[model samples]
Target: MFYRLMKMIVAPMLKIFFRPWVEGMENIPAEGPAIIASNHLSFSDSFFLPALMKRRVTFIAKSEYFTGTGVKGKLTAAFFKGVGQLPVDRSGVRGAGEAAISSGIEVIKRGELFGVYPEGTRSPDGKLYRGKVGGVARIALATGAPVIPVAMIDTEKLQPPGQVKPNFGVRPGIRIGAPLDFSRYHGMENDRFILRSVTDEVMYEIMRLSGQEYVDIYATAAKRQIQEAKKQAKQSGAEKQP
Candidate 1:
């Protein structure tokens, strides 16, 4: 009841505010357990597409979102909650993957539509990065759900990293690809590799719709780690030089 009311209220408001141009919404199942896979671009990306969708789509949000308290924090929590998101803590170095997979599988088992970003995190460079097979395909294979590839363009431009509000003029939009069926590969008997390949195929479709540059390297939390190491080494060498 709350989910339905949320869909009713939020969808129209988003359309008016974002003026989003939607495509291929027909690809989404009017009824069934399905997964919508896409590349992550911005914080607003989650809210944007779900507003365009007719069905109630749920995504996994970081647990911090639910824990925070304040004006902005409560508003943020309310927005996510209204949009059918459940908190999944993907914060630590370990156990995060297991936790996510378990939560996702449970969501699917209830015959709900699930949303996942295959690229794992937002593109720092606006280029589609390699996907970590982690738990997306695992849940799909486990639940026998079809994966729908969606591409959101200009979303990053709407709310680039630090700003509190969207820039408000860029007309955000989405291009959805056809639903991918992995029925042929079903029941492969715990074949993780095959599941990854299936994940890649779904990502390939998203790349086509999004038209973003592709990077084969995995998205790592080590970006700052590597940069800081290089900086320290350079400073040390300079001090020794004279």
Candidate 2:
């Protein structure tokens, strides 16, 4: 109910202000369960994708989005809830992967579109990163749903990682690729090698559609290295100031 209301208000606003362009939307199944795997470029990717889609796309958000304190936190929680996002524990909790897999399986079994970022986290430097296969592959194989590769173009520029507000008037593009059938790997959900192959195939399609340079490292690992480099640079600068 809240999701629909917010969409009614937010979708038109996005269409008019951002003027988002969508291609291959017909590729999204009009009904039934399917996984919508896409490249995560910006926080705005969440807002833009669901706002533009006719069918609801449910993504798993970190628990902090709902557990924060204060009025700001409350508002944030309400917004995400209304946007149809589910909260999951990403704080190194044991069985976190299993929890996510179960949540995804439940959603797909209910015959709804399940949105996932196989890259695991948003790209740190605009290049497509290697995908994390744990949950994505399990859900797809567990439920036998087709995985559709989606490319969210120019979303990073609309609202880059650290920015507070979106750059209005910038139209991001969405390209929905055809459904990827993994029936050949069906019933092999427990096989790690098969999971990696399927995930890589999905990522390849996203890279092709979005036209982003591909990086073979996991995004989270890359983010850590980048953060460490920045910290060292800052320390060097501080020492020079003395």
Candidate 3:
């Protein structure tokens, strides 16, 4: 009920304001369980992808989004919940990855579309990063669900991190790739090499669709490098300021 209400107002506004164009939407199955595996570029990637889809896509968000304190926290929780997002504890728990995969399997068994970011986190740079296999690959092999590669083109420009409002009148592009089936690797989810092979293939398709440069390193590592570089620059500047 709340999801529908928020969509009623938010969807139209996004279409008019952002003017995103979608291609290969026919690849999306009309019904049944499937996973929409996409590259994480910006915060709005979640919002824009589902707004244009005919079916509801649920993505696992951080539990912090749902556990805020105060009136502002309540509103934040309501908005994320209304958008069909489920929360998982991403606080470095040993079972965090397992919990995410379990949640995805349940959603797939229910014959609903489950969205996942194979990279595990947003790209610190625009380049497509290596995928983390524990969530998407494990769930697909476990449930026999097809994986669809989705590309959120240039969404980073629309609403880069720390920007409260999106830049209007910018047209973002969404491309959906053909569904990938990994039934060949069924029952091999526990095999580390098989999981890496499956995850690499999915990231390749996303890179093709998004036309972004592929990076072999994980996004998290790249973020750390960027932060360290910034810190050094700041310290250097402080030394020079006599």
Candidate 4:
């Protein structure tokens, strides 16, 4: 009820303001379970993708979004909950991965659309990063669900990292590729090699759709490198100031 209400209020406003376009509406199945494996370009990627879809799509969100202490935190938690996002604690790597996969499997079992950012985190520089191996592949293989690759274009420009407000006049879009069938690898979810192969295949399709430069390193690693470089540059500037 809340999901529908939010969409009713928010979707039209987004369409009017942003004029966001979509390229592959038919690629989305009319019904049944599927894993929406998308390239995470911006925080708005979550909003734009679901707004355009006919069916509800649920994504695994960080627990922090739900655990805020003040009034702002309460609203944030309510909004995410209303939108059908599941919260997974990301403090422990293995535990978080397993929890996400488990949540996805349950969604798939209920014959709903389960969205996942195969890149694991938003790209640090608007380039496609190599996908992490566990969650998407494990869920797809476990549930025999088709993996759909979606590319969110120009969203980073709309709201880049750390920006509180979105920039207008930038038209964002979604490019959906055909469903990838990993049915042949069904029951091999535990095999690490199979997981990597499946994940790479999905990431390749996302790259093709988004036309973004592909980086082989993980997005998290890229973000760390960027932060370290900024820290070093700041130190060098301080030294020069003295």
Candidate 5:
């Protein structure tokens, strides 16, 4: 019920507003378990890709958006919830990854679509970074669901970083790639080599679609450090407020 309602309401509004140009949409099965792996560029990339396709695509979003106090926060939370986003706390380093994979696997097990940004977070410099490969590969191997690579072009520009509002006229494109079946890798549950191979294949598809340079190393940890710094600064400010 929630998925259908979102598909009908928010999806159309998004399609109209963005005037999205989509390609290779046929890659997605009309109804089945699949994972949409996309590059992260902007926050809006989440809302845009899901709206471009008629089928409900579930992305594991940061828990903050789904938990809030004000009306604005509540509305944002409700919208994402309606569109099939499950919140996972990304605050901690160890547990968040496991939680994300578990939630995504549950969605796939229920025979629904799940979306993941293998790069983990938005690219700071618009380059495709090496994927973590843990969550996506594990879920696909577990559920036997085909992984579909999705790429977004100009989404970062559509809704520029940190700007709450998007510029009305920019057109965004979504490129979908063929479904990947790792049946050959079947039964290698404990094999690390097999998992990395399949995850690389999925990311390769994303690179082909987005035409972005791929990095062998993962995204920089500088952003996380900056976040920690900000929190510490805030705490210091509160303590000094005598």
Candidate 6:
């Protein structure tokens, strides 16, 4: 109920303001379970994809969004819950992956759209990153759901990292590709090789659609490297100050 209400109220405002466009709407099945495997560009990727889609697409959000400690935290949690996002605890790497897989399987079992980012985290530099093999492939094989590759274009520009308000005059778009069927590897979700292959194929499709430069490293690792570089730069600046 809340999801529908929010969609009704918020979706149109987003559409008019952002002028977001989508291609390949017919690629989305009119009904039935499917995994929406998309490239993670910006935080707004979550908001725009769902608002523009006709059906409710549930994504696994980080648990921190739901467990904040202040008034803003409570409102954030409420908004996410109201929008029907499932929260997965990301403290433990292994546990978080398993929990996301389990949640995805349940969503697919109910014959609904389960959205996932195979890259596992938002791209640090707007480039497509190598996908982790655990979440999307494992769930798709486990539930026999087709994977739909979605590309969120120019979303990072709309609201870049650390920006509180979205900048106008930038038009975003979603490009949905035909669903990639993986029934040939049914019940082989445990095969690590198969998982990697499936994930890579999905990433390749996203790269093609979004036209993003492909990076073979995981997004998490890229973020870590970026943070380390920033720390080193700060240290060097302090040394020069003395």
Candidate that would win on lDDT? 4
Residue range with the least summed lDDT across 10 consecutive positions in model 3: 161-170
* Model 2: worst 10 consecutive residues (lDDT sum): 91-100
Ranking by TM-score: 4, 6, 3, 2, 1, 5
- Span of 10 residues, lowest total lDDT, candidate 4: 74-83
Estimate, for each residue in 116-174, the C-alpha lDDT of model 5 and write its tens digit: 99988888667788888687888888788888998999887877777778877788889
Whole-model lDDT, model 1: 0.81
Clashes of 1: 0
Per-model C-alpha lDDT, please? 0.81, 0.90, 0.89, 0.92, 0.83, 0.91
Model 6, residue 43: distance off in Å is 1.0
Off by over 4 Å in 2: 69-72
User: Whose TM-score is greatest here?
Assistant: 4
> Cα miss at 189, model 4 (Å)?
0.7
TM-score of every prediction relative to native: 0.88, 0.94, 0.95, 0.96, 0.86, 0.95
- Name model 6 segments beyond 4 Å from true: 69-75
Candidates 3 and 4 compared: the better one by lDDT is 4
Candidate 1 similarity to native, TM-score: 0.88
Off by over 4 Å in 1: 1-5, 225-242
Q: How many backbone clashes does candidate 2 have?
A: 0
Candidate 4 lDDT over 1-242, as tens digits, reads 87887688778888999999999989999999999999998888877888778889999999998898888688667767767999999999899988899999999999999999998999999999999989899999999999999999999999999885899979999999999999999999999999999999999999999999999999999999999999999999999995
Q: What clash pairs does model 2 have?
A: none
Q: Write the per-residue lDDT of candidate 6 for residues 142-166, one digit (tens) a residue.
A: 9899999999999999988777588
